[model samples]
Target: MTLSVKAVAARLEIGRIDWSAYRAPASGGPGLRDLFLGLLDANDESEAVGCSLEYRLEVQSMVYEVALPAVGVILAAYAEDLPLWVEMEFLNVLHNIITGEPHRSELELGNFDLVDRCIERARDGIWVMYSRLSKWNSDFLLDVLEVVDSDRERFAVFKAGFYPE
Candidate 1:
């Protein structure tokens, strides 16, 4: 499944949507570096400095919490193939949370090199963080994991000469 808002809504069985809340706010808070560092910091207590947000991305409920490293991992892992708009939307949410500002720039979603580098840098952290994700995020991650498994299966079949090109 694609990571569109509509797809997420359908998966969540949401009936209607209000799009305004997902719009990016004006940029004013911290920069991306601080935002990412905050995510990676394990000592940050949610009860003290938590920014909990509830968003309906096209109708699906996304209760996002700042300081959840898994959220960053999931976004980075799925960053490569998503549509540009979807990638922007994800970044907008993160920016909103971090800097209290909406994202005004677009990132090249196809550039997996940065993502790969980050993954290599945070391999163990990502692994530990994945288990700490909330159920909603974990479910979404499972869906993507299924897609990866399906792709692996298809590739294996092709290698076994099941289909001729």
Candidate 2:
């Protein structure tokens, strides 16, 4: 479902809710999902950052903390580092394609492949992390607790998932 930024803002105001309240059991489930998807899509399009108010409400309800580091890592892993690495690899590929010379170091080729794999995995990891974050939508305090408790686990999962496959 395509959600306009204005539509999201309207929903937020209509509910008389803070982003944290979207996690309340009283909140309807579909509403939360739609908001999450909308926010994700916006982020994907570079139209917005992290989560929208609607998304924040859903996440806050779920007891998750929407923090910078977590968001930064995901953005960097996919939008920045992956693309940079891909560009570098593309240059190498172009050189090879033009020169008709085999790359001397298998390590270089392997590294390029590894970086490509890392980008794919990082994309997947971000999706999983977002899914987990979206699961709750009522108890802001609880979500914060859960995020804190799972901090290391979440970071480790991201690292392992994003590492070259």
Candidate 3:
């Protein structure tokens, strides 16, 4: 099910596609932001273990309204891949930020520096997992949406029907 980036770009309806070689920036850019659409790569046939794109958004970026078509598409296709533990972590952090929970307490308790560091790490971890399963190729993504038609299902059926299960 692997596909070239351009094919993905086309399927995702990205009119202008760019395929520059990825390079790590020397240092973090000030006021520069990016919205990445990630694609998950499977460790085997059934389970996803890694991704091609991981992005972060600054707090100020949230102020403006934007339509992230890729995010919606990816989420619809691969929502099942989102692990529960990750969901829990996301919810916890979101609750803390919204209600001024433990995170605020830490800030007021002279752990401001430590809290900031933890917040940054947590942001990285959450975004990595959130973006890890995104991709283009709407057809393949739709194919994945077919619950009974996966390769893993066929393999399992073979193991049950032919070999002892």
Best model number under TM-score = 1
- CA shift of 96, model 2, Å: 51
For model 3 the TM-score comes to: 0.22
After superposing candidate 2, which stretches have Cα over 4 Å from the reference? Answer: 1-28, 43-165
Q: lDDT by residue for model 3 over 30-71, one digit each (tens)?
A: 211221222222323234223212221112122101112222
> Lowest-lDDT window of 10 residues in candidate 2?
61-70
lDDT of 2 at 14: 31
> What lDDT is obtained when candidate 1 is compared to the true structure?
0.31
- Model 3 CA deviation exceeding 4 Å by range: 1-39, 42-67, 80-165
lDDT of all predictions: 0.31, 0.31, 0.29
lDDT of 1 by residue, 1-165 (tens): 344332342222211222222222232122322333233332334522433222421112221222133234335533334333343334444333332221123123233233233233334333333343334344343333322233566434433442236
Q: Write the per-residue lDDT of candidate 2 for residues 62-92, one digit (tens) a residue.
A: 2122211122223332232222322232222
Q: Estimated TM-score per prediction?
A: 0.26, 0.20, 0.22
Give the worst 10-residue stretch by lDDT in candidate 1: 56-65
Model 1 regions lying over 4 Å from their true place: 1-30, 47-138, 147-165
Model 3 lDDT-worst window of ten: 57-66
For model 2, what is the alpha-carbon lDDT of residue 5?
Answer: 45
C-alpha RMSD of each candidate structure in angstroms: 16.1, 20.3, 15.5
